[model samples]
Target: MENEISSKSTYRLLYRVKPFLAITFLQFGFAGMDVFSKVALNQGVSNYVLVVYRHAIATAVIAPFAVILDKKVRPKMTFSIFTKLMLLSLLEPVIDQNLYYFGLKYTTATFAAAMYNILPAITFLMACVFGLEKVTLKSIHSQAKVVGTVATVAGAMLMTLVKGPVIELIWTKGRNNQGVKGGGTNIHDSIKGSLMITVGCFSWACFIILQAITLKTYPAELSLTAWICLLGTAQGTIVALVMERGKTSVWSIHWDTKFLAALYSGIVCSGLAYYIQGVVMKDRGPVFVTAFNPLSMIIVAVMSSFILAEQMYLGRVIGAIVIVAGLYFVVWGKSKEYKSGSPSTDGQMVQDKQMTDTSSDSNENSTPEVITLNVSSRGGATRDEQINRQSDQLLV
Candidate 1:
């Protein structure tokens, strides 16, 4: 019993921390995506074109995994659900990619990351408004969630609006003094870039909320992911075909560091990372999956400094601090709430409990004796104690 209790408690603690970790890793992962992608795109790979190629390659890679372990998958081939998954793919991969790349044209990488700090707060509000998530102020955990979200948003605003000191650059004359000299992507451009990326971030946030519902009908996350990526690939290809079909030379192959970067991103970043994320989502849930965005920010910040020499301005530092503080509150609030209200045997939710009786069937027919129990939290204020019906638990 004590072992069971300890395991259950540990699970609960992990669950509470899940969101923070998910968002952190996501942020870091995307940081790599942002920097590498910009380099590739600069060499004439439009974001649209890159996403098209990436989705196609990723779907091809994921195909073998999905096909090999077909038995363990769930949701068993339904057309209606397939349609929904495809639609979601359009929302996240297609629309989101367009916004992101378009924004990148105008914004610096650091500025984009700074604005994106608002995503978690935006997601929470969107989820609640859409009836996809429930929030309450009755519990300290819920309140903490609220407070953290607010602070994070405020920090994003700070980073977005404040201008940092500009650095001067001396560029070698390019044939006739053309091509990137003396000034960076201007402050105005950064603001514009920040705005566009913020829109993209919110679009992604919407996708996160939709994920919970998507998982219910399409339990095979890998299968659903394959469909989504395939659909997204189709969409991106269509867009590319329409736009870059004439300038096909711009999209020509060049085996260089950029090509290697794209290959890594397509195969490992988009392909493998996405699959693993879904697997974790199945076990951990959506909030757990998305909570790791902050880690990406820190990673990106360090990378941008060494790789791009982007300055760590006071604004960005303050924003990072604020966002991290918010992350702490959200995690803490969830943990405290889970402890107080979530069902427990001395603060641990029950696992499989069987109630067996040794009485004769005749005497037990009219009276109840033993019952079964299973427990999970619904993130409510009340101490949620759910007693579900059992298959063969005996009475008396």
Candidate 2:
């Protein structure tokens, strides 16, 4: 009886902090990747080769797990879903990641991360245009989201355009003065790099919109992620071969920092990060997932300062604070909206029981679907079971 009580308390604690923990893990992992990738890029590793190796490793690791974990209830693959996955591969690892890494090669990691703060606004606009989001200006929730988006945009621009006084950090300055040299972030290169990251953000927004739609058809998160990695590996390999054609030296990987970059990024940033995101999106919503992106900016900024001895300007600090404020506003609005609009516990319990019945009766000749996915819902139905039931309904 005592043991059972302990276990229940642990479960309750974990459930309460899951969202915070997930986003925190993601930001730290991503920040580490940024630092490692920068070091590899500085060591003259080709961006295309980095992409190929990263995705290849991600595919290998994720595929077996996906197959094993999702085998029982995994939906059969269709040509249509495969086509959409292919497009997703092209959008993310191909266009978005390629541009992002290349831009990272030229700019400071802090700046590169700050540029990504614009993604929420870009995604919000795309969602509105695609009819996925319904915006009522009269609603405080909607207004908060809109204003937060605008603030995020303003913060990004401020960081990009305005370079102010450097905030003195004694540790970074003293350490750097002792013969350590930071990477160059020249004005001209910074401009070019910023533009690339901006475009990458646009591609990422498109990817999110498409991924949401695709999840309606292909509800198997792990399976979908594995497919994306596999296809992305192929696409990245083709790009790498084309770019490094006749240059055998570019393909060489020593058991050094470059190799570590590929391995760590493949396992953590690509495979695990994407999987965590899929789970988070299914539990919460996309806005909630993206709302934590600004946290990454903060993480990267602090990490870059300590690791690279990178200078922090007043503008960057001020802008990052603004971005974080905006992020909280957006999250607050989303939370309020979810609470106000979401169904009560009794209704959710009824739906959960209905879904359980539908899933038990489901068979192969079914289309998968998911509906009303909310983080705050206190239903007994698990996310996967919910998706399974939705898939069963699709068949009808």
lDDT of each: 0.62, 0.76
User: How many clashes (backbone N, Cα, C below 3 Å) per candidate?
Assistant: 17, 2
Q: How much does each candidate deviate from the true structure in C-alpha RMSD?
A: 8.0, 6.4
Write candidate 1's Cα lDDT for 202-230 as tens digits: 88887766755676556566676677778
Clashes of 2: 2
Query: Model 2, residue 307: what's the lDDT?
Result: 80
Instruction: List ranges where model 1 is wrong by over 4 Å.
Output: 1-24, 164-184, 280-285, 339-396
In model 2, the Cα lDDT at residue 246 comes to 96
Instruction: For model 1, give the 10-residue run with minimal summed lDDT.
Output: 387-396
TM-score of each: 0.76, 0.84
lDDT (10s digit) by residue, model 2, range 1-396? 576555655654565468768977988888888888887887888889998899899999999999999897577788998899999999988899899988997787888888998888888887777655657888888889888888888888888777799889876776541232224346777888989999999998888778766766666788888988899999998988988899889888989999999999988888887778766655555566677787888888888888877888899888988988898788777666655544312123224434754575575444444254442446556544544454445444
Which pairs clash in model 2? 368-391, 369-391
